[model samples]
Structure formats: structure tokens, C-alpha cells
Target chain A: MMTSPDSTGTVPVTALTGLSAFPLTPLKDGQLDQTAFIGLVQRLVAAGVDSITVLGSTGSYMYLDRAERERVIRLAVQHAAGIPVLAGVGAMRTEHVLAHIDDARAAGAAGVLLAPVGYQRLDDDEVFELFRAATGRSELPVVVYDNPSTTHFTFSNQLYGRIAQLPGIISIKIPGVPADPEKARAHVAAIRAVLPEHVGIGVSGDAFGAAGLIAGCDTWFTAVGGTIPVPMLGITRAVQAGEPAKAQALSEDLQPLWELIGQCGSLRVSAAIAERQGLAAPDCLPLPVQGLKPDQRAQLALMLDRLGLASL
Target chain B: MMTSPDSTGTVPVTALTGLSAFPLTPLKDGQLDQTAFIGLVQRLVAAGVDSITVLGSTGSYMYLDRAERERVIRLAVQHAAGIPVLAGVGAMRTEHVLAHIDDARAAGAAGVLLAPVGYQRLDDDEVFELFRAATGRSELPVVVYDNPSTTHFTFSNQLYGRIAQLPGIISIKIPGVPADPEKARAHVAAIRAVLPEHVGIGVSGDAFGAAGLIAGCDTWFTAVGGTIPVPMLGITRAVQAGEPAKAQALSEDLQPLWELIGQCGSLRVSAAIAERQGLAAPDCLPLPVQGLKPDQRAQLALMLDRLGLASL
Candidate 1:
């Protein structure tokens, strides 16, 4: 899976390609549910995800404290077996992000994801300087995370070009590609045209994974893959095996679940899925983020049954 | 300014009315410039403001760590010189927010401002529950801060009605009133209709402050007023004396400054103003938030001079 390094001689940028599962940091009794968390991580490892990313939006990284985040990073690295662990180190302040990066490096994380998390609306230059300071602070490979859904900061292609020029930036995790096949290819291609050859462009938003991959996204940073990795891996492997039709059909089969995820955020629905499958405690999500209503849970159960994902 | 008790007997809800200035937390060499911050507090007190609100978005509260926030809270209270100090205790997690409420209470703050600061977009129910937990945690009066520019979580009128039902919510700090006078009055009236009589409606966005005050808003939550309070107090006094024209004229005289604020955001503009006034050291803003470009600073300086605000 190694490729020749283009700029940052140390990091194999191609390692960022393929399925990177972002697992949730489940909690029990107002504390980190280590057993459940490890189980989730082990599932990703067993399903042979290309990389395991902890403390992402799916992981409720913002809700957890420093010590809790450190624990998640350590546990993820410890139980990931041989899978490369990428930890999210985003915080409201750049200094805190640097501290998280240090912790991730100390905990043996293969890379770190940095999002321009905002309270005050951030301008293009501020976001660029944040990445500049972050890349300067650590040697670990960096992924420029642009999730406007959570961070509320959008990245322009020009800004992406500016950031990718910095050393150690191995990937750019875009929010998603366009839904249509041709538009999605054009969108990813436009971004790819700006980025260096060594930096990979990964796609998020679970439902867009197959289209993004078939359109030439280097990786699919899947949220549901953390809890239900089998289907996600099926789509990923199908795309890798040059079976675009199979990948599209597999993705279409999960439309009901994606519809539910669209109704409720992926974070809550993923927690509900894990809980329904007996993979985590009933209330695995952090407080102020109750998973789902009873009716919603019932609907999710029926949807899973219809999708034949009830047993998975 | 004291008034009879409401549901929360201990908090003086009426004290939240009139002009409440939100000051910047200027930093020096990566540490809080306590002397500069105290001077800002003293300015508000000497200007005879109704209350001084510290640790707001203008204060860069989200960018600070717990220890820094504690220091700012303590220093603000210590130097407010008996002026009621309202501290922002908003965090991403309810538990962390509760802990901040504890800190604000311990620091002798007169009230606490809560905003649903979101990384994941919070639903109305979650925001309501957050306030319920916060009010249950402390006896201080609470101001529901609804600044969508920073928090990215908009509070609907329905959500405001729901949160106002909670005890200790003395005021709702709305983003702004409409620009048109008649529309502004109707806007405030609509919100007031949903709120309890005891709960006041405050307005933010410096440009809209005078319009809001003239339209029956109980308080003007101002960013520019924090750095330069004389003109702000003039506007407030004129409105109180039933001279809406004078207040409108005063607000219009500073259109240049408001335009700057609108362009660069209040935080960066306020920092630049503080730095220019020699109240705070150069480069007062924290890392990754460089105050302003040289051209913007030049424009701000000219605006201050044209408005005859440079001497103040």
C-alpha cells in the first residue's frame, strides 16, 4: 500500500487511501465505555478498514475533555492491532490543537485530523495560519478536515491549495462530492487539480462514499463503517475491485439507513445502531446529546430489519 | 435598578436592563493582559453602564482554556467596582458548561450568559435541556445568548419561549433587531410576547444597538461600547430621556466603525481598536486570530478620527 513520497519524505501519503472508519467514543454511566469502545475499534480492525480514525465528529470529540480524548487515543492505538490510527486533534484554540497533536504523536497515532472548529466565524487567512501552525508543531501526517456541518467553516479550493502546499499534509478530507456521477467526478477532479500529487483527497458523508470512490476519491471516511463495517467494507472493496455497479447497488440498499441518518445526524443514529445491536450501552452518547426518541429508535429498528442489517 | 423577584427569587432580573458592555480579553505574550482587561472593566464602570458582561464572543471566551476563563472571570469581578458582571459560561458539553457556571458563581459574577455553542448542530430539545441543567446547577440570573454568527446555533422564537420558561433566565440576548424602526419595534414586540414579563430582551450587533434600544429592547448588548463607552452611554441616555432622534444621530455618526465591524467581525475589530487606543499591547488577540491587516487597521484609525473617537 506504500507509494513514493512527493514532498514529505517520511509519510506514505498513499497509506491514506481506501476505507478509514471513524469510530464513536461510546460512554456508560457518564464515563468512557472502554469495553464498548475497544469492541468498536476491534470491529473496524477485523473488517480490515484501511485506517481507524478516533475522536471524529462521529466520536463526539468536542463533547469529551482532554483526559477523555487522550484515553480514547491511547485505547484506539492499543486495540487497533496493526491498523493505522488517525486521531482528530481539533479544538477551539490553536494552542490546544497543538497539545492534542503532541498527545496523538505520543500515543502512536499514524496521523492527525485538524478541523477549523469555530466560535467566531473564521476567515480564510485565519484557517490557513491554523494549519500552518499545526503542521509546524508536529511531524505526523496531517489531514485537513473540512466538515462545515460541525465546524461551520467552509474551505474554498484556493484555500485548500494554500494548505496542501504546507509540508506534512498528506490528505484533505472534503465534506463530500456532488451526488450525480458526472458532477461528483468533476467536483473531485477540480479539487484534485489544485492539490499536490502526494496529498490524498478523502470523502465524508456516508451516502456519498460510493459515488466519491467511483469518481476517484482516494478514501471514504465512513461514519457508519465504525458500527456496521461489513457493508461499508463491501462497498469499498467492490469499488476497489472495479465493480462500480456492485458498489452502487450495495450503497442503494442502505438508502433507508442513510435516510434515517439524514433525518437524525450520523452521530446519534450510529450510537442508536450500536446500542440496538447490543454493541454498546443503551445510552452510549454523551449527555446533552440523547441518542434518539423511542419512536425514532423503533423506526430505526424497522429500517435495519428491512435493510437486512438487523443481525450485523 | 433592583426589582421584585421572579421565579428565581435571589437574582435581580431588572438589573440586566439598559446598556451591558461586552469587553475584549486582551492577551500579551500569549497570556491574559490582566491590567488591560481591568482597565476595560473600569471604563464600563466609569461610563455608568448598567452591567459589564465579560467572557463573551468579544472577549474570546471559546478560545480560552478553563484556567484562562477563570482568571478573566475573577479579574473582571474584582475590577468591575460593584457593577454587575455577567460571565458567559457556554461550552460544547453540558457538563463542562455546568463546571463553568460553578466557576462564574465562585468568582462572584452577578449573572451567567448561556449560548448553545455547537460543534454538532444542537436541536431545540437539547438546547432546552441544557438550560434546564444549567439553571438547576446555579442560582445566578441567566442570559440566553443567541449569537448565530459565532455559535452557529440559531434560537427560534419557539425555542426562546421554551428556554424562557426555565427559572433564572432573566434576559435573552438576541443577535439584533431589524434595521427599519417600525420593523425593529415589531420584532422586539414579537419576542416580548413570547417571553415572561420579568424576562428582558437585550440586543447585540453594535450597528443595531440604537435601533434596538429605541424599539423597546430592555438592554443593548454592545461590542464597540466595550472599547469606547462615552458615545454608547450618550446614545443610551438620549434614548432614556425620550430623545430617539439624538440616539439615532449618535448611532449614525459611527456608521464607519459599524461597517468595519460588519466587515471584519467584532472580535478582530475590537481587538484592533483596543490596540490602537494603547489600552492593550500590540498583538493583543490570541494566536491564530491576528487582529487585522495593516490596511484594515488604517481604515479603522481613519474611522475613529473622522468620528472624533480617537481621543476617547
Candidate 2:
């Protein structure tokens, strides 16, 4: 049973079940578009997302300045109201991570999902030291983020086993096998076998294997969920309730949208999907990332239409 | 003849020339190590450096939070006095670049070296758009940084030619071919042929081709120059005066030290050399960077001793 850090002094590690949507941070005239962002958050909340994650790679956190990140987190917290908001706080240095952690706590973040040093490969000791320092700095629970494809360093199963034991670490967010469901299922099983049952394990390859990851782990994080939260949330909940047929049908309805998003690259795809759903502007990326191709946008629109989510 | 932006009632494009050393911004206990940084700048100035470029990729700019970057730039301007300080102002977004440009100008930077987005791959138009936006935002002359190896996006001759006509851009900093003098020579010739003669071209390969690049182009930039400024300044002067024998002799004397510094990766290697020379502390990296290896350190010390820079 997960307990609240505030109430029970041992917050129950809530299973991050259902669609955990990470909304793209909107930018207008070179600054955070808070009004648009808040509206998007409201829409996602209304659509019944299980949790909200801000400042993830999809949210363009790397491109945001520190002050902007703080403001975004604060806005997310306020708009999210009772929904849990997980702030992405990973950086190359432990000190930077600590600073972000402090900001996340002050901003009322429910937890922080940290990406390891993104630039270079870090040794096991350095990685451990980073987590130790981060956990020490923030009272809130931390989610160890391991996306080797993006960060260029995957936390070995051994490292994950060690991190799993660290205090205040409530969960691990692993991106399911790069593109294969079978491999992802195996990875989920391997990670689940080692981690304590109380510590939730969430998979980030949202639409690809939301059902499988839900079957294997405790939660499913989806970029698409940020736009069409209801369907994804319904699918995950159904899968968890042992309604595999209903879950499969719902997932089928969501697959085209997910595949279309997967085509634009991670960050851009997320942002593009958000824009198509009226969650963000089309040109919301930092440098190095261009907007989606017209054909991709058309495909997304068609997918939304097929799912009867075009209006929302 | 390079003219000031204020000249002719139009922004005069001043070509940033000579070895523009981007010295490491030192930190102690999570705060800016102003004393150490200023001392390093003083050494660079006393050694007759043509210009001081702070917060480049070699300086770990990405790891620094915005406030830290601004603070470092402000301190650099204050300490640099008459020597022109070119602050590096590059990011993944146009606004971030604009903000850096504003900060650099406010800090009294002589110019801004704009690094293209380092993380993602951008097409020609996007790259051009980034430079265009930066140049448009800055009152000070902008140097189009073309270190593709680090940015992961090399500027083609066509792309360079397109942006070469921009109003504020006046130079390009090209890293010399690694361990290949012929390639270095070819790069210089090719870049120079396309870039206007008035637009300065600077090379960064430390001691290896400092003279060759100077012999081939108008100027050379050195990571080593920020620490052992006297020797680098001597070599630059010799090259400028067309004294190949003197320049070659100085280059030969400094070759081993440069090679040793080169052994460690750029950021850590530069920091290590700076610390060994008593310029900065060894642990001052912003975050996400590891220190030099034992063998690398010993090799550096040996080279310093052989070059009579052991006192450093």
C-alpha cells in the first residue's frame, strides 16, 4: 500500500496506471504561452488522465530556461489541481538536478522524473551519486528515468536493482523496447522481477504496447494521452481490470494516432500531436526541431477523425 | 577594414580576429569562482590575447543555468577591460539565442559567437533561420560558429555562402582537422575561398595547427591559449609576423602539452589544463562532465615540465 509523505509520512507509491499524459509546453513570441498551456492542461484533466508529466523531452524541457521551467511547473501544478504532476528534472550535473528538484517541490510537483546525464555516458558510481544527491535534495518521491535510446546510456538491470532500493524512489519510467513488443514484454518482466512490488514500474512507449506494459507493469505513459486522454485512460483501466478484448479494441482505435506520432521523432511527434488536438501551437519546438510534414499532419487528422476525437 | 556597427549610421561588421580563447568559467561549492576566473582572464590579457571568447562549448555553456551564464559573462566583461570579450550565445531556440545576445551586449561583450543548435540535426533552412534570427536580434557583430563536429551539423559551402551575406556576421570558427594537417590545410583553403576576404576565419586545433591555420587563414583560436596564454600569444605573433621558423619552434615546444590536453575530451581537457596551470580548480565543470584520467594528468604534467610551464 502506498502512503502519503504528508499524511502517513510514507506516501503510498500510487500505481501510475492509465494514460499519463505529458503535454507539450506551448511557446508564443519566444516565451511560454501560459494561457494556451493551462487550457491544454484543463482539457487533458477533463478528459480524465491519470497523471500529468511536465518538462519531459516531449515538453521541450531541455530548451526551457530555468525560470521558465519553474513557471511552467507552477502553472502545471495550479491547473492540474488534484491530478499528480511529475516534473522532468534530469540534467548532466547533480547540482543542476538538485536545483530543479527544489524547484519542483516548491512548485508542488507530485514527483520528479529524472533523465540521467544526456550528453555523455556516466559510470555507475556517478549515476548512483546523482540519484543519491537528488533524493537527498528533495523530499518528494523521484522516478528514475532510463531512456537509453535518447540519453545514450541505459541503466543496466543491476543498476536499476540498486536504484530500486534507494529511499524516496517510488518508481522507474522505462521506455519499452525501442520498437519491438516482444522485447518490451521481456524487458518489463526482467525489470518487474527485480523491483519491489510496492515500487511502481511505468512504461513510456504509450500506444505501442500500452496493454502489454499495463499487463506487465503498473502504468503506461503516453504522449498521445496528452491529446486524447479519455480513450487511452479507458484502454489502460480496461486492461488492468482483465478486459483484454475491450483494451485491445480501444488500443486499435488509438494505434493509428500513435504510429503517426511515432513517425515525427519523439519530441516533434509529441508536439505535433498536441497541436493537432488544439493542445499546443504547431511551431512549439526549440531549435534543431522543425514542424511536422503536411502529410504527417493529415495522417494525424485522419486518425483523430477515425477515433471520433477530431473535435476535442 | 572592419568597421564598427555605429559607423556610417549602419551597424559596422567587425571581423573577430586572432586566437579567441574561451576560458573556463570556474565555480567553487556551486557558486561562481570569480577570483579564479578573473585571474585566468588577467593572464590571458597580460599574455596579449587578441580577444577573449567566454562560454563556448569548450567552456561548458550548456551545463550552466541562465543566471550562471549571465553572471559569468558579466564578470568576464568587467575583468577583460580593453580586450574585446566575445560571449558565446547559442541555444536550441531563437529566443534563447536572442536573450543571450541581449545579455552579452548588456555585459559589454565585443561580439557574440553563435553556436548552432547542438542536439538535433537541422536542415539548411532551419540553420539559416537560426543565424538570421540571432543576427537580426544582436546590435553587436555575430560570428557564425561552424564547429559541426560538436554541433553535429556541418555548414555546407552553399549554406555558409547564404548566411555569409547577413548584416552582423563577420567570422567563422572552424575546428582544425583532428590529427590531420593536410585536412586542416584543405579546410582552411576551402572555407576561405567561399568566405569573403573581409570576413575573418579562425581555426581551433590548439598547438598542432595554430601556426598552420594562422599561416593559412587570418587567425587561430586555442583552448590552450586560455591557460598558457603567453606561449600561444608568442606563437600567434610569430605567425602574424611571417616568422615561420620562430612560429614552428614555438609550436614544436608546445606540441606535447597541446597533444596531452587534447587527449582528454575538450571540456574536461581544457578544465584540467586550466587547473594544472593554476588558472581554475579541477572540479569546476558546470555539471555532467567527468574529470581527466590518471594517465592523462601525468602526461599533461610531463608536457608542462618539458615546455618550461611547470610553474603553471
State TM-scores per candidate: 0.96, 0.86
What TM-score should be assigned to candidate 1? 0.96
Top lDDT: which candidate number?
A: 1
What is chain B's TM-score across the candidates, in the order shown?
A: 0.95, 0.90
Q: Model 1, stretches more than 4 Å misplaced?
A: A1-14, B1-14
Clashing pairs in 1: none
What digit string (tens of lDDT, one per residue) describes model 1 on residues A94-134? 88899899888777778899999888778899999999999
lDDT tens readout by residue for model 2, A14-70: 556666788878786566888878987898879877789888877777777678898
Candidate lDDT scores, in order, read 0.88, 0.72
Fnat for every candidate: 0.74, 0.44
* Model 2 DockQ (Cα-based): 0.37
